[model samples]
Target: MSIRSGLFKLLGLCLLAGVLVAGIMFPVVGAAGVISNQASETVESMSSSLADEPPPLVTTLTDREGKPFATLYEQYRIPTTSDQISEAMKWAIISVEDRRFYDHHGVDWKGTLRAAISNSSGGDMQGASTLTQQYVKNYLINVTYRGDELGQQKAQEASLARKLKEARIAIQLETKMTKEEILTGYLNVVEFSRQIYGVGAAAQAYFGTTAAELNVPQSALLAAMVNNPAVLDPWNNPEKAKERRNFVLDKMVENRKLAKEDAEKFKEEPLGVLPGGPDKPASTCVSADPAFGFFCQYVEDHLVEDLGMDKDDLYTGGYVIRTTMDRKATLEAKKAAEEEVRKDEPNVANTLSVIKPGKDSHEVVALVANKDYGTDSAAGQTVYGLPYEVFNVTGAGSSFKIFTAAAAMEQKKYGIFDTVPVPNFHVSPVFNWGGEHCPTRPSGVRTYCVSNASDGADTSMSLQDALAKSPNTTFVILEEETGMGPVVEMASKLGLRKTMASRPADGRQPDPDHEKPEYSMSQKEFYGPNELAPNGRGMFTLGASPVSGLELANVAATIMSGGVWCSPTPVLEVNDRAGKPFPVKEPECEQVVPEELANTLAVGLSKDTQPGGTAASAAAAAGWDRPMIGKTGTTQFQGSAAFVGATPQLAAAAMVFRPDIPYGGLSYGGPGNVHATANGNMFGGMTPAQTWFRAMKPIMADLPPEPLPQPDPAYTKMR
Candidate 1:
C-alpha cells in the first residue's frame, strides 16, 4: 500500500477504537430495564423520551355559530397520515435520503465504515446518516433550540458528539416504531421552508395541492429541497433546484423505484413549479378579515388580559376559541356606520356598539367602526377601531345627561318632573371662581354663560322636557342644585367607568389658564385630571366627561334591564384539541340603582324620541313602531355627536367624531364634509342619531318587543 493509504487506514482504526471505548464508558439504561454497553443502548433512552413529547399545535378561532374565522400558529404545520401521503413522494424521499432504509437497522454500519474510510483519506466526505438519524437530529434541534437563535446554532454544530448521539437515538427509534410510522412522523416534523413545516403544509405551499395529490416531478422537487432548502428553493434558484431534482430522479431509477425511461423523461421536463408565494397563515387579529378583525382582537385581549392566559399558548396551544359575535348583527352595524357616515369626508369616523339587555346578557352582539379594521397607510392611522368601550375611550357629550337625571331621582332631591329654567344662556357662581372669563359686571355679580343649541327665550320646563330638548342651561341649574357628587356616583354605578377613567373627586374640567404648547392629548385626557384640577366646573352636567361607546351602551343596557348591570363579556366558550369544554366566565350582574328610579329615568329619557324631541328626526328616520328610549348629546362647538338608545330587549350607542383633528372645539360639518357644517353646527340628532337609528332598526327588527317599564306612581304623581 502507498504511504498515504497506510496512514489513512491506521487513522480509521484509531477512530473506531475510540468510539468503542466511549460507548463502553457511557453505557446507558435501555428498554426492558436492561443496562447495555452498546452505543445504541444510550440512544434508546434519549430517543424514546424525545419521541413521546411533541411541539405545540396550532390554535383555532371561531365565531359564535362555530364557523372558523381565523387560525393562530407559530409554525404553519398540519400533520398528515401515512395513507394520505403519495407513493411518489414516499419513494422520492427514500431514494434520495436513504436508499437502504428498509434493508438496514437505524445505524447503517456499512455506510458509516465507508464514510470513515473516505473522510480519513481526505476524499470528498460522504454523509453516512440514515433517515432515522436525520429525523433524530431534527427532533433534537426543535425540542432544544426552538425560539432560541444561539441554541439552534449549537444544536446543528457539525461535531462528533452530535453525530454519535443521533446515531444512538436512531438505532433505538427503529426498535420502537415501524418504518412507515417513522417515515410519517419524520415528514410531519421536518421544516420545509420559512415559517412552513410538515409535508402537508409544504405540498399546499408549493403547488396549492395536498400531499396525496403531488405528482412525481413535484415530489422529486420537494425531496431535493430537504437537503438544502435555502440553496434548492425552486422559486429562487431554479438552476440549482433543477439539478438537485434530476439527481433525486436518477436515484429513484437507480433504486428501481422508477424506470430508467421515466427518469430520463422527467429530467427533460421543465421544473413546473406553480407561480405563488409561501402560504403564511394568519397568526393574529391584524391578519383577520376586516369584518371580524376588531372582534377578534377583543377576544384575544380578553384571553390574555382578563383570563390571564399565556400569550404563547394563545398562539400555539391549539385551544379552540369561540366568541359571542352575531354575524348578521355585526355586519349590519358595520353597514350602518359606513353608510350613515359621509365617505367623501375621510376624516370623519363613526362607531356603533350593540348589546342585549338582561340579567344573563354578557355577550357584546356587535361592535363596528366605519374605518376598515387594519392599518390605513394613506390616512396615517395605525388603529382602525373606534373608541371602543374596552380599548379606547372618548367624550359622550349630552348623552351623559341620563346619568345626571338618574342621580337626581336616586338622591330624592328632584323627580323627573322637577322644573328648571331653560334659557339661551345662563351663568353660575362656581364658573367665576376659577377664571377671569366670568368677570363681575356693574350688577356686582359674576356670571358664567351656559347656552342651549336652540338659543331659546327664557322659559321654565320640566326636567323630562329639558332632557328631551338637551338644553345646557337646564342641566347646569339642576347639577348645581343636586351637586356633582351624585352625578359621578350614578355614572359609576352603571358601567360608564368600567373601561374608562373614574370620575375625579374634585369635578373639574380642563383649565384654560394652564395652556400647553401642544394640544394633542386625547379627549379622555382633556376631561381627566391631567389637564384639569379636581374642582367643580359649571359645564360638568353638560356631558364633559369622556366615555367609551361600549360604556355608553352598557349604561343604556343597564337602564333597559331596570337597574341590573351585566358586565360585558366577548367570549362564549373555549375548547381543547379533543373538543373537551373549558371553563368560561358567566355574566356578572349587580343592582346599581332601584328599579323604580331606573324605570323613571328610562321613561323620562324616552321623550327624546318624541315628535318634538331633540332626536325626533332620527326616530322618524328609523321608522320603528316599537317602544324605544334614547338621548342625544353634542359636545362644545360640536366636537363629538353621540346618541344612546335602548329597547327592552337590546341597547346600542353610536358616536361621530374626527380623531385626527384635535379636540379644540372643531365641528363635524353636514354630509360630504367634516370641517364645515351645512346646518351651521353638528348635533347628536344628525349623524350619530342617524347612525344609531339605521343600525338599531335592522338589529331589532326580528327580536320580540317588550314595553318599557312604567315609572313609579309616586314619581309620576310629582309630575
Candidate 2:
C-alpha cells in the first residue's frame, strides 16, 4: 500500500475503535450490554459484601518542633487526565509512545499487532502502550508489582487485566474530557523518580530547569523515559539511553514533529544535565551514632505521623523538610575538622558530632570531620549505620565533671575550699583494662593540684585546683562524698542522655553490680543501683556512662543561654507548597537548677583554659577572641571526642570518633604501634577544638564581637 493510503487506513481504524469503546460503555444499552450489566451487578454485590474498613489516615511531615511539611497522597480513587500534564510533554510522549494517540480510543490495535508479531522473534516483548495504559500501570495496577496500596518497586510483573481496565477507563475519560486534558493529566501524574511525581518533577530532575523552560530536546528525552525507564535511565545503561533517544528522534521526524536532519543533530546531542541538583527533596541521613541519629529520627518519625504518612509514602514521596539546623555552624566545623583526619590516614575511621542550642531545639550538626556532611559521610554512604543507629560509644571524661560539681554544690558535698581527702585517686577501685590504676593519686595540699592521671601519686589540692586540673581524685572524692543520686538527677536535668555505663565509676558508691546507670535514676540518692540499669554501673564518675556531644552541648548551650533551656534543633521552619506556616506546639523545659549553677559550670569551663587545666591546649588553640569554654572527652579504643561551647552569637557542640576503632586506630599503620594516649589525651582536643574554632570563627567574622556573658563577679568563690 502507498504511504498516504496506509496512514489513512490507520486513522480510520483508530476512529472506529473510538466508537467501539463508546458503544461498550453502557452495560444496559448496547454491544456486550448484558455482560457489562452483569459485571456491574457483580461489582455492586462485592462492594456491599465488604468487611470493615476506615478512611485512609492522613499523616504529615514536620520540622523539629512538629510543624507540617507535606501530606501523603490524598486522592483515593486514582484519576488520570491530560490537563494535569504539560502540553509539550503530551505531544512528545505521544510522538514516541503512540503516534496515533489523538485518534485512538485507548489501545492502539495496529501497534499491538506489530508488537505481538515482533515478539515471536523476541528477547522481550516490545510494549505497545498508550497514555491510558501507562496511567493504569502507574496508579491502578501492579504492572511492576503493584499491591493493595503502593508497593515498593521490586521484582518485575505485568498486568493484562489492568491494561483492559485502563482501556475502559480511557473510554470513560475521553467522554468526560478532551484529548488534551487526558494527556495533560497523564503528564502531571507520571513518576519521574527523585521523589518527584509528574511533569513538574521531570522538569526539575532533567534540566535543573523548570517545566515551563523545557525545550523540545529536553522534553523529548523525558518523554522517552516514560515508556521504559531502563532504556532511558541516564545514570545506568547510557548506551540503551542513547538508543532510546535516537528512536524518539526518529519518531518525531516521521510524525513531522522534527526535521530529519534536525532529529539527527538532536540525537547526536550529548545530554547536558539540568543545572541544579536533582529534583529529589533532601532529608537528613542519620548515622549509626545512636545519640542524635535517634533524635533526628525522632523528628522524622513524628513528622511522618504528623503528616499522616505510611512508611512507603514518606520514603518515596516528595517532601519539603524543615529543620532547626544551623547549617553554617555545623558545616564550618565539619570542614575545619578532619581536614587532617584523613591525614591520620590508612583506614583509621573517625566520626564527629556537633549540636546547637535554641529555645526549643537540640540536634547533632556534624558527625565526623565532614565524614557524613552531605550525601557522603558515614551517614550518606550508610556505612556508619541506618537511621537510629549508634556509631561511637565514648567515655565522657572531665566534661562529666560539670554535673558532678553541680551536685557537689547542690548536695553540700563539699564547699569550694572545703577540704576532702585530697589524695591521688590512681589506686581507687576504678582500674584500667590491664589492671593498671589511674596515675591521678593526690596527697596533701599540693596533691589536689595534681591531674586525673597523675602516675598514681599522693597530693592535696583545693577543690578549685582540682576542678581546673581535672584531678580524677577531685571528682572521685567529690563523687564519693557528693553521691551519684544527685549527679544522675542533675545530669538529666541538664540534658544528658540516659546511657548504659559499664562501670560503677571512680567514686560512686552503692554500686556493687557493674550495671549501666539510669536516666530513670531517682529514689536512691546514689546514681542508682546496678539492678535498675544493667549497663549503668561501674564507672559512674569519670563518665563511665556515655553521653553524646549533642546532649552535652545542649546542656552547655542551655547554660550559655542563661539557664533558659535552649534545645538543639536541626531544622528552622517548615513551609507548605505556598509557603504557609503550620501550627506547632512550643517546647518547654524547666530550670531544674538555679542560673548560678550554669554560671559556675561556665566558670569551670573558663578556668580550665587557664594555666593549669585539662583543656589548656584547646584554650590556647583558639585566639581567645571568640573565647570559648569547652570540655574534652576521650574513650579508650574508639577514641571518642567532643567539645561543646559557644560564641556570643551562637552555641554548638563538636563530637568525633573512629567508631569503636581501637584507641589503637588513633596510631599510625607502621612499625611504631603507639599503644594509646592518656584518657584526657589524643586528638579529640586538636580535632574537636579545631572543629569548634572553624565553626565559630566564620560566624564570629560575620558579626560584630559582643562581650562575653560574664557570670556573677562575686560568685567566683565556689566555696
Candidate 3:
C-alpha cells in the first residue's frame, strides 16, 4: 500500500483506456472506406449497359414488281422502350433474378436489407445486388463471379463495394438519362442466351424478327431467357422455357401489362425455334432452292454495295429501294410455270423465276412437290416459303434454254427466225449425252426434231421452231454457230452466274468468307477479269452451270417484257427517326434485248408445245391441250422442263419437279415421270402450267387484257 503501488495501478488503467479508443476509431474508418469504394464503382458498371455497337443492317428483298418478299433483319434490332419491352420477358428476369429493379437504383438497398435479414434468419444463401450491379460485375467489371458453383452469387454478394459503386451510378444515370434509357441500357446488356446480349437481339433469336415485331408469345418466350439464359434458352429448353414463359405471363396478367385475350393467345401459340440458329448470319435466305437462295443473297450483297449504304442502315435505317418489275408480266410468267407443276409428275418438277428488264428485283414462285422443306427423300417433300430469308435450290434442266438462247441471240449468231437447221447427225468436239457427241444426229438435215439424243441422230429445224420445241440438235448447231466466249458474256448480261454452293459442279464447297465463290475454278472460267464464275462453253448451255430459278425467271422476264432490268426495290419509302415516310427514288429500266426479238422468239416457242416438242406436255397443261410453246431437257442428274410464254396482259414461265426420280438411272421417265409433276403425265404443260394458270387467274383478273405483241417479220429462224 505505498505510493509506487498506486502509480503502477494508475498506469495500467491508462493503457486499457488507450486500447479501447483505438478499437472504436478503426471500425469507423473501415466502414467509411467500404462506402467510398461502393460509390466509385457504381457508375462505371452501369455505363456498359446502354452502350450501342452498330448492328449489321437487315437486307430486305422484293419481288420483280418491287414488293417485299422477305425482311432480312440483323439484331431484329428494334429501338424499344421499357413500355415496349414485353411484360413477359421483363418479369422472367425480375421474378427469377432481381425483383427490385424498378424500386431501386443500380444498387438494391431493400434487397440487401432483406438478404441481411435472411442471413440472420440462418439461410444458406443471400442475394441483394441489383441487376445493374450484376451486369457491371459480369461485363464492365470483368466478370468476377466465375469461380465456384455458387461463386458468381457469392462473388456478386461480396461486391457491396461494387454494389455501392453501381448504386451511385444508377442515381447518376437516372438524373443524366431517362427511365427509358436506363431500361434500354439494361436490356442491351442483359445476357439472354448463347451470344445473345440485348433484348433487341433476343427478339430475333426467338422470333426471327425485331423487338417491336415480337408478339406476346414471342416476347414471353424471350423474357424467359433472363432467368437462366443458357438453361432456358427456349430453343434449347422447351419445358423449362414454357414454364418460365408462363410464369412471366401470369405476372403480366397479375400486373395488368397484358389483356387476358393476349395472354391466352400467347399461351396457346406454339414455340418453335428457327431451323438456322438464333441470329441469322448475313446472306442467309430461306428459299425453295439453296442455289436460288445463294443468288438472292448475292443480289442483296451487291445491293448494299451498289446503293452505298450500311446494311444496318439500308435495312433498318429505313431506306426504300425501287425496282424495275412488271407485276403483270411476272404474274403471267408465274402462272404459266405453276400450271405445269399442278400435274405433279414424279419426273417433272416445276418453278418460275422472273425478273423485269434492267431491274435487279425478281419474282420466284415455285410449285414444290412437298411442304416439308427439310428433306427431298420423302415422296411428297416440298419446300415451304419462297419468301423466307434463307433458302437455296439447284436450278436444273430446261432453265438452260435461257442461257443457250441468250448466248445465241446475244452474239448475233442467230435471230429469232434464223434457220440454223436442226441437224439429223450432230457430232462435234463437245461431249453429248453419255459422252457420245454433240448434235445427236449425223445428218444436218432440217426438221423440228425435239431430242434425237436417244437415236444418236437428228433432223434439222429453224431456230424459232427448234427453240420452241427445245430440240437438242437445233441448239447444238446454234452452240456451234455462237462460240462459248460470246455465249458466256451474254449469260452474264442476263444476270446468270455459274458458281454454286454445294453438290460439286455448280455446287462446290462454298467459301465462308466470300459469297460468290461456289466453284473453286470459277474465277478462272468466266465472270469479269479474275472473278468467281464460269463463262459459257459449248457444254455449258445444257444446265452445266448454276443459275437460280429466280435468276432464270429474271432472264426470261427481261426478254418477255420489253427489257427493263432496274434495281430491285423492297420498301416503298424510307422513314425518318420521327416516323415520317419519304418516297425513295424509282430506278430506270434498260433495253437488255430488242422487244421485237423477244416477241418473235416467244411466238415461235409457242409451237413447240403444239405436238412432239420437248416441253409439249407442259404446254398442253395450260388448256392448250396440245400445241403451245415450251422446252424440255433431261440431264443425267435431273430432268429440265419449262414453258415461257406471253399471253395478252401476261408473260411468264414455269417449271415442275421430278422428285427422287433419277434419269440415266432405273426410272428413265419416258413411260411415266415425263414432267415431274403430281401425276405421271405431269409436264410443263401439266402441273407447272396448271399452277401458273391458277396463280395467273387471280392476278390478271383485276387488269384489262393487253394484246400479245407480234414478232418482227424480218427476224430469221435458226432451222
Candidate 4:
C-alpha cells in the first residue's frame, strides 16, 4: 500500500456519501413544494368563489309601531358589523381560540409545529387553525352546504386535504380583507349550535341579549361553545359547559384579556344561560293575534297580489312594512262583532269591515269576522278578508234601493215629496209573462210579482216615507219611473259593478208560474244587460245583486264623504334593509256622484233610524250619541242580512249568514232556530244592524262628531 492509493480511496468514499444525501433530499424538497402549490391554488379558488357572495341573513317584519312581529330566515342569523359587536366577545374568542390571532398573517408556523408534534405523539389532535383559517372553513361550509345536505357533510369531513385547503384559503383571505373585517366575518358565520349561526343569533338564542351587549362571562361561555356546541350546550350538558367556560376564562386571563381574579369570579357564577327553546314568530295569520289575523292577512295579500311583490321576497326580503291598520279601531270592531254575534248564534258567520275615507288614501281600519282566520284543521273557519269583500257579492237586499232613489232624484224628475205606489204584492209591468196564471200584459212586457215584508202596504206614499219604511213595492215603482239605465248607472258610479252594460229596453215576458225565473237571468244579463227597462225584471229594487261587505261599506262611506269614493288600502309604507323607502301605491279617490244627490240620498237613508222606520229600533239600540244613517238589507227567504252604516268620520258594514250554504238557501234561522224567536224571521235590521251599532260605538269614540250635510236646496225645493 502506498500514500497515493490511500488518498484516492478516502476521496471515493466521500463522493459516494455526497451522492446518497443528494438522492434523498432532492425528492423530499420537490414534493413539499408541489403540495404547497396545490394547497395554495385550492385556497385561491375557494376564496375567489365566495368573495362576492353575502352571508345569509334574516328578514324581519315589524308592525306599524316598529315592533318586530315576525321573522323569516333560513338560519335565524342577524348579521352585525364589527362596530355592533362587543370588544369582550372578540377578545374572549381570540384569546381562547387563537392567542396569536392578530400577530399571525393567516397561519401560525409555531402553533402548527406544536400541533403536528402533539398529533403525531398519539394525543388528541391539536387544532392549529387561526381565526382566519376558521373563517375560511366556515365560509366554505356555509356556501357549500346552505341548501345541500351532502355538501355540508363533505365540508366538515375530518381530512388532511380539507384542512390544507382551509389553511391555504385563509392565507389568501388575509390579503383581501383587514384583520377587523376578517374577525367580523368570522364572528358572523361561525356556528354556535344547531341551527344557530353567527354571534347575533347565538346571543339571542343563548342569552337573550344582542351581540353588542354581551358581558365578559356571557361572551366567554359563547366562545367556549364554538369548539363543540353539542357537548358544551349549557341546557343539555351544564357541567361540561361550565368546565369549558372556565377553561376559556382561564385562557383569557393568560392572554391578559381579563384579570385572574375576574376569571375566578366568572367561574364561580352559574352557567346563567337564558335559552329560548324555540321561536314563535308570527309567520302566518294563524300565529298572529286573533283580533289582527284577518287584517294582517289582508295586508299580506295586498303586498303579493295588488302590489306585485314576490311572495318569497315578501317573507324573506327583510322588509320593514308599515301597514294602514288602525289597531284601536280593529280591536274595537272585533270586540263588537264577537260580543254581539258569537253569543247568540255560534254557527252564524258575520263579517265587519271599517274604513277611513281619506282625500287620497282610504285606510282599512279593521276587517274582522266571528271566526279566527288560519289554516289549522282545528281552526275551522273561512278567511273573510279582502277577497271575501271584493269578490263574494252577497245579495244587497233592500239596502240597494238607494240607487233607484238616487237615480230618480238625480234625474230631477222626482223628489223626497213625490208619491209612489206601495202594494203588498206588485209586479213590474215591463217583465213579459206566459201561462194562464199571468194576466194579459203589454207587448214586450213581463209580470214579475214582488211582495213586501208587510202585507198592509197597498198605498201610495212620499219618497222619503217609502225610503224610511224600506217598502219593496215603492222602490220597484220608483225604478219603473226612473228607468233601469239611470238606476244601474247610479250604482255603477258608486263603484257597484266591476263590469256594466245597458239594460234591454224590451224583452220577452216569462211565465208567472215559471220556476227559477231569477236563475234564468244569466250573469251577462244582470251585469252586461243590453236594453233599458222600468226595472231589472222587478227584482233590481229587491237587492238581487251580490256585493261584498267592503263594497257596501265604501258605498256608505261615499255618501258620508259627500260622494268621494276612495279605494281601500291596507299598507301605508314599506322600507328596505338599508332604511330606504320603497314605492307604495297611494289611495285613489274620485267623485262618483254629485254632492247634492249624495246628500239627499244620505238624508233619505237617515230616516231609517227614526220612528216608524225599518231600522229605527237598531239605530236606537246602537246607543250612538251622534247622528248616524244606514240601511238594512234582508235577502229573500232570509238567506243573508246586512247593515251598512256610517257617521261623518267612520263607515262600516256587517253581514250575517251561513257561509257554507248558497246565498238563497235556508235562512240563518227563523222562529226558534237561531236568529229569530217567536213567529218572526230574521231581518237585516236585526243582527246586522245590532252588530254595526256595537262596532261603530267604540270606533266613533275617538273621532270628533261632524253632522251630516243637509240636502241641497234644489232637491229640497221639491218637498
Work out the TM-score per prediction: 0.83, 0.68, 0.58, 0.71
Ranking by lDDT: 1, 4, 2, 3
lDDT of each: 0.72, 0.51, 0.48, 0.69
Q: Candidate 3: count the clashes.
A: 128
What would the per-residue lDDT of candidate 1 be over residues 1-719, giving only the tens digit for each residue?
Answer: 99999898788788775783464245445652344454454566667765666555678878799888877777777768899999999999999999999988787777776665565556532378788887776666655466788867755665556656666677778878889988887787777767667788889888888999988898998899888888888878989999999999999998899999998999988877667666656767777777677777777766776678788877766788887888888889888877776434566667888888886664688877776666764542235446363322235678878877787777676677777678776776444332345568565655566667777654887778878987887777767666666666677678775433432211223343544412333223433233242334455566644566877888989988878888777787889766798776654689899888888888888788888788897788778677878898887667667889999888888887665543333434333234332221247887778888888888777888778899886554343
lDDT of 2 by residue, 398-442 (tens): 667777777787665554445545554334332221233234434
lDDT of 1 at 180: 90
Report RMSD for candidate 1: 5.5
Give lDDT: candidate 2, residue 619.
Answer: 61
On a 0 to 100 scale, what is the lDDT of residue 585 in model 4? 69
Residues 1-719 of candidate 3 have per-residue lDDT tens digits of 88998898667545544432332222324877676455445344445343433223344455445665444543343346676666555655555456666776555655655554454446522366566555544444222332244755543464323344444555555555554455555665566666455777677765677665666667677666665678886666778888877777776676666777777777766776676567544323453233334234444554564445455555444333333334454445443433334323343445554322223433333323222223352443344333222122333445466556766765566767666665545554432233423234354422222344454233655666666555555565566566655555555554443322232233344445554343344421432223222223344555534334444445555555654444333333354444566444434556656666666656655565566665455435534432223444444334433444444333444544343332233235443244323343333444445554545546556656554457776445433
Predicted model with the maximum TM-score: 1
- Where does candidate 4 stray beyond 4 Å? 1-79, 91-177, 186-198, 216-281, 343-346, 375-396, 407-413, 429-447, 477-492, 496-526, 530-546, 662-682, 713-719
Give residue 593's error in model 3 in angstroms: 3.8
Q: Ten residues in a row with the worst lDDT in model 1? A: 502-511
lDDT of 3: 0.48
What does the lDDT read for residue 457 in candidate 4? 36
